[model samples]
Target: MAFEGLASKLQETIKKLKGKGKLSEKDIKEAMREVKLALLEADVNFKVVKNFVKDVSEKCLGNEVLESLTPGQQVIKIVNDELTKLMGESESKLELNSNGISVIMLVGLQGAGKTTMAGKLALKLRKDNKKPLLVACDVYRPAAIKQLQVVGKSIDIPVFTMGDQTSPVDIAKASIEHAKSIGCNVVIVDTAGRLHIDEELMDELKDIKEYVNPNEILLVVDSMTGQDAVNVAESFNSKLELSGVILTKLDGDTRGGAALSIRAMTEKPIKFVGMGEKMSDLETFYPERMASRILGMGDVLSLIEKAQEAIDEEKAQELGNRMLNQEFNFEDFLSMLEQMKNLGPLGKILEMMPGANAKELKDLDLSQGEKEMSKIESIIHSMTLEERRKPSIIIASPSRKKRIANGSGTSIQEVNKILKHYELMKKTMKNMKGMQKGMQKKMKKGLFGKLPF
Candidate 1:
């Protein structure tokens, strides 16, 4: 939901264009005007917004677009391409040292979640078969060192620390030696942060940078700060020559001006983003995928990646076979629920789906859905194995239904509703399988299916 407001507005504006078989200059101008207002209202930097609208207008007004059979689609493609360009066109990777240990210095303001991002990055590297050493360089903040230690401990990564009395520069230099001694290939230094930018803090960071000569100087910023986040990145890049940025709390940023404007303003790529509170929630930033999401075109590639990470292929196949054979039961239902939960929030999952607009998504009460799922689970748990496998028997036996209702702390009416819905779902699945087979036949005859959107 990072760009909910902007995405909704852009999607609505483009929806109008898509409805037209032929477009005029007046129509393109009207759409661009709406887009400009949306970006400005989302808190984008004024100059960035102005340049973006100008570039998009120029491309959309070309004869190739205005004279094309699908003028609206052409305009969308142009906007998508320009949006990707605005955010650094491609993914920016972390700099790795080939000869020796790769050292990364995390720089940011105090409330930017730098310590947590260090743990997240270290966790990611550890998963990628690199031995990472986390160095405690923030000795000023109360409990900052202890917090990093806690993070390192949770992730099972080793933390190197000297006493608070030691200067950060010495600590960073010594950490590299420790990493070499232990054969750690990556060193992540969690540096101190000030409430606001200050000369003293900058001097300290610069001193540490001189001592360590880090491979990557990543600035972590809070995306919810909007234009202030962009301004902060500019300030940090000026002093540190920052290699990239890590935007934290992106899930909480609805306006998303900082994400859209930072790279344009600082010429720095966003290497990573903090999507959720979990250490595993840090994701590499992909500009093209983000642009697609912003325009409501959906990010199918990211959705597939998330599914690949969260689901077991063999189990999924097995479950599919069961459904096809009409053998799916309460156990399979519970297992599928667990797997879906692993894919993150339902709202986020819907955002990656084609044609799922912001208004409809906002109307989806995920918490209420979760509550309903919990109730179903409780009902299923109260059933006997035989009843789970063959729900018809329970439906036929009023006594059994009453027993389950008592066990699940619900009325018999709720039990009937659960059974009714389960039957409806099975019936729907059967119809879908039949439709899929029909589509397969058509596909074999050289017919391609159209997208639902």
Candidate 2:
């Protein structure tokens, strides 16, 4: 949804190469120019665009456009590969010392979700069987400590906070001591954010780093800030020698420039991304999947990776068989949705795609629907096992709809929509499976060819 515009644009461009027997110099040059303009219009960084286009040209030029392929696809593949390389080859992982307490210091600009990300990391660390303690080092923002407290409470993790009365350095030192006392192995210290580049903020962070001797110094940056974020990252790296970045607000209207430029600019790999404000919305950054999404190719790799991380292999295999057999139901739908949350927020997934801007995804704002989904899940959970296996039984029971709505804190209309969508998906998948072979090949070719005047 977020990538519809970008998808259309790229598809239009790639269409020209659909049936080409060979590519001339003119064809490659013209196509590359068009791609350059598109990237610029999409708000990609100027220098990044230049370097990317050049790299793609160098990699793809003079290569034969095979009899079965068009020249455009060759360029697209090159671009995708280079983009992946530019971001980083493998997924970055935050190091945690197993033998002793691992301290992480988080620094970022104001409103970059530093406090929320701290709690998310703590939750992830906890799930990994490590005893994680959250340190509230933000002695600046009045509500920052309370925000961390709420996040910590929701995740059931310990919060080491001194409120706004103490210095951040002192608080961080005390927090590490507290972690030792409590036998916690991980301490994620959430530090203060500044409005802009300021000595006070840097000095404060430097002091905290010196005192805590953190294992990881992660800089959280807003992806929507674009080039500004690159500048901030550069500054932070120069001052603190940051280990990595945590790109935040990626669910918003962002051009992806920050993600593309930060690594090249600061030489620090992005370890994670904060997709949403929810405690479960943080995710590990994967460059290849992101490259695929940006190129409008879809990211099946990320989907597979997420499934592996959150769902059992046997269960997922069973679900895949059910899908192939057109037996996907509400039960399967609920499981997939829950697994998706573990991957990252829905909005962030959309943003990772080329055409999935924030504006087109306005209707897909899941934050507001959190309560509704919870209720729907509860209502579904309350249904009899037989009813869940066979939704048709509930369809005949009109009173069942009202009962579920009331029990789940939703309206009858919401329940109906879910049921309708579920049925429609089943029917669609069934039809798709039986579709004619080579239909995709025919569809790839234009229905009409233009006349040469």
Candidate 3:
């Protein structure tokens, strides 16, 4: 959703090229012109867009593409490669000191969501088997320290605070000693922020940097600010020599200017991006995967990673076996539904799939789909344990269907539809089982002989 407008425009331009069997210079120029306009409309830096178009146009006109059998696909690959290079080319990992404690100081303007990112980073570190201590160095804003404490408590991590009476510089200096005593290997300092950049804010941040000698100084920025976010990163880099950047609010209706321009402008990699408001929504930045998503190629790797993190492998295997054996009842359906919900929103999952039409995705009413799932879940919940295990009983008894409808606040017709669908699924599974057996018999008869097992 971050680059909805830009992605749509770029995909449309590429689709035209893909339709052609041979690409002329005129076609490449027209496509590049459309791409240039799209990037400018998305609020990317003007100079960056100019250079990007010039480079892409030169490559498109080359013999390697113009003379190729699959010229259209070749052009798309060039664009994808250029886009990846424009962003960071690869993921940038955090610089963790394995020998001793590592300090990470977060700096940004007010409303950039630094405090929340601190907690997210700490939780991620804990999952990586590190003991993290959150230091509340933001003493200027009202309730800043309290907010950090609440975030740390929610994650079951320790927080170090010395109240508003102490200077942030001194607070950061002392938090390290506390971390050492508590055996914390990572120290995250949440520094103060101003509404705008000023000498006063820079001085305090620089002081903290000098005192702590932090291994990483990450600047958290709001991606929705467009070119303003780029300017903020430039100013901070000039002053503090920032190690990297973290873009927040990426899940919102942003034009994606900062994400596309920051690395080329500042020569710093984006370490992470805030995808949602949940504490677990922070994701490592992957430039190639993002370019693939923008070009409508999808990102299957990230989707697989999310599924691995959210679903239990044992439960998944058991459910698969049950479904193939035609033993999948309402109870298994309910369990499967819950597991799918853990992999984030349905819209996001759809976006990760290859060949998903952009216009169709935009027109889809995903909230309606969510409501339907809730309806199905409620209907399943209203059934008795025996009825769930053996759906035949519910189908045979009209009174039981009426009772379930009343309990779930639905009509009898809806209940009947669910029963019909379940029966259809079981029948399909049985057909699949028979087909598999037939294939095995054919293999034993030497029809397929000596498979590469």
What TM-score would each prediction reach against the true structure? 0.88, 0.74, 0.94
- Once model 1 is optimally superposed onto the true structure by TM-score, how far is the C-alpha of residue 267 displaced, in angstroms? 0.2
| Candidates by TM-score, descending order | 3, 1, 2
lDDT of 1 by residue, 97-136 (tens): 7778999999999878999999999999987889999999
True lDDT of residue 135, candidate 3: 95
Model 2's alpha-carbon lDDT is: 0.76
Better model by lDDT: candidate 1 vs candidate 3: 3
Best by lDDT: 3
357-402: candidate 2 lDDT, tens digit per residue? 3334545666766666666688788676777778887778889888
Each prediction's whole-model lDDT (CA): 0.91, 0.76, 0.92
Tens digits of per-residue lDDT, candidate 3, 233-344, equal 9999998999999999887744788899999999999999998988989899999998998888999999999999899999999998998999999999999999998899
In model 3, the runs with Cα more than 4 Å from the true position are: 437-453
Show model 1 residue runs off by greater than 4 Å: 321-328, 382-404, 419-453
Name the candidate that leads on TM-score. 3
